[model samples]
Target: MIADIDGNASVSNATGKPLTKRGEATRTRLLEAAEVVFAEQGYHEASIVKITERAGIGLGTFYLYFDSKQSIFEALVIDLNRRVRHSMAEAMAGTSDRIAAERAGFAGFFRFTAQHPALYRVVREAEFVSPEVLKLHYTRIVEGYEAGLARAKESGDIDRRLDPEVTAWALMGMGELIGMRFLLWERDENGLPPAQLDERVFTAMTQMIDNALAPRREGNHDD
Candidate 1:
């Protein structure tokens, strides 16, 4: 799970010079190619030539956007993180409340995961290939999530006892594992992951979330 906190893409090239429209497009092409190549071949096996070949760009052109394979790999992680966060935010838009927002947001996440299964592999590889980017990926998602949870807590929409930061990480972990099981593991007869998470699993997951986050009643007591 990842999201761009700043919502800004790089406007310059590797040399610290502003990129022209064409240059930006080429950079995007390289990043896109890197995403697939890295996902398919682990960082140890992936090469600049492979990425350039996949992008149909020359070897020399690759250096203009990324100084090395590691650089491009890091960039791809950020790119995927930004895009996935955007997908969640887009789905969450106009929801009535935090609970609704959670449902929509998770739905968006699973949808993107289905379309871009590379996110899981590439991110996992980042743990070894570039630990810092891996941290950035999770931190970015949790930052936004914590902010939202804090707002909900202030509004009394969620359990006041819940620590926003802790709850945010917990919920993110739940979503991550659930997506891995239902979206990444399951396959159709066509040998592709489902286009969306199963409604039954979604319902069960949300019910659990609602139970966890719902405010406690004054008279309610549990041993």
Candidate 2:
């Protein structure tokens, strides 16, 4: 399990308190250091020595907290996923409609990517290149999305013929595709004001999501 406040072993086999202040501090430092290192250099290129140096800790100290650089990377991904889920939960708590919920959810996601560009890059890379990491990061969110689809079906909000699981995954894919385009700067652009660029991107995303979920008109329900 996890450790106590003084940075000592709090658990003797099983029973113990949370991490000590020093333990927690060390943990935070490692995570911060890993985040920067992983962001600066892709996961394959990042080294334990670099991360420890950034954390200002010894190599043995790194092992005391984590097994390997891969473990730390997994921890970082899990941490980011938790933060994203928390943000989505907060946004969803106030909205009932699916479209409204998606809008708020995507807005929160957009803000997160805007704020944590490096982390976003890491997540995007993992999606295409690391199946294990992708599943680890996405399983919970996919479960929740499936639940929403079930609700939509029950309410006659979605076509009863559509598989909820497939629909949920498709929705997730759509969001990720849009996010990659917006945040990755995949297109070539020179110097521009950051604020204007952010605003333009945010507005474009809001419109994209709106159009994506717009209600089908009577005659146009040809699907």
Candidate 3:
């Protein structure tokens, strides 16, 4: 089964009918293939033929799932967004506090980004291929982040003065750029990103986050 933008179970086909287990598997294959094709070749250069070829599925089978290239592209964006957020949430699970959650969540994000560098390329191209999905991607991530930050603020784990919405965006932007600069840009002997983010970079980044979010003590005026 596939998930819609709202995280509901979705058929993910033009027919809107429930898919059998095998059908679900085929749709997943197409999406996986679409990820690589869209990443390697931008939207304009990518074609349904290319995606199907990569999937090793028949060309006619493509339309059964998606009516057009744009539809699949949009679906792929949502799919990637869901998976990445899941990675972060999974890693943050069982953490004791917001600070710990933040570190674990970011570690999860970087790990996924390292494994799927195509995430960066595909999402960036979404701005052109499908602007709405691009917004949805970022908004979905921020919604969860803002909710977490809001809870922390209420519990005195973070600065009460900080607006959760704004802070969420700021922190998300920080993570994206940091990953792009370090993990995405750096490559190993095999020309692949390191399996994990650098310890030094992660420590420095988390320190900055901690200092910014940590609660202010009484009578401490060091702004």
Scored against the true structure, residue 87 in model 1 reaches a CA lDDT of: 96
Per-residue lDDT tens digits of candidate 2, residues 1-223? 1122112233111133355677868877888888889888888888999999998999988877777666677666766776777777677777867767776776676566555666576776676545577576677678878897678666756555657788678777776766666655543464211221256665776676555555555667766
RMSD, every candidate, angstroms: 2.7, 5.7, 2.1
Top-down TM-score ranking: 3, 1, 2
**Runs in model 2 with CA error above 4 Å?**
1-18, 124-130, 157-161, 186-220
User: Considering lDDT, which of the candidate structures 2 and 3 is the better prediction for this target?
Assistant: 3
Best by lDDT: 3
How many backbone collisions does model 3 have? 0
**Candidate 3 residue-wise lDDT, 1-223, digit = tens:** 2235554365656677677889989999999999999888889999999999999999999888888888888888888898899999999999999988999999999999998888999899988877888899999999999999999999999888899999999999999999999998898888799899999999999999998888888779576
TM-score of each: 0.93, 0.74, 0.95
Off by over 4 Å in 1: 1-9, 189-191, 221-223
Q: lDDT of each prediction vs. the true structure? A: 0.86, 0.66, 0.89
Model 2 TM-score is 0.74
Q: How close is candidate 3 to the true structure, as a TM-score?
A: 0.95
Winner of 2 and 3 under TM-score = 3
Number of clashes recorded per candidate: 0, 6, 0
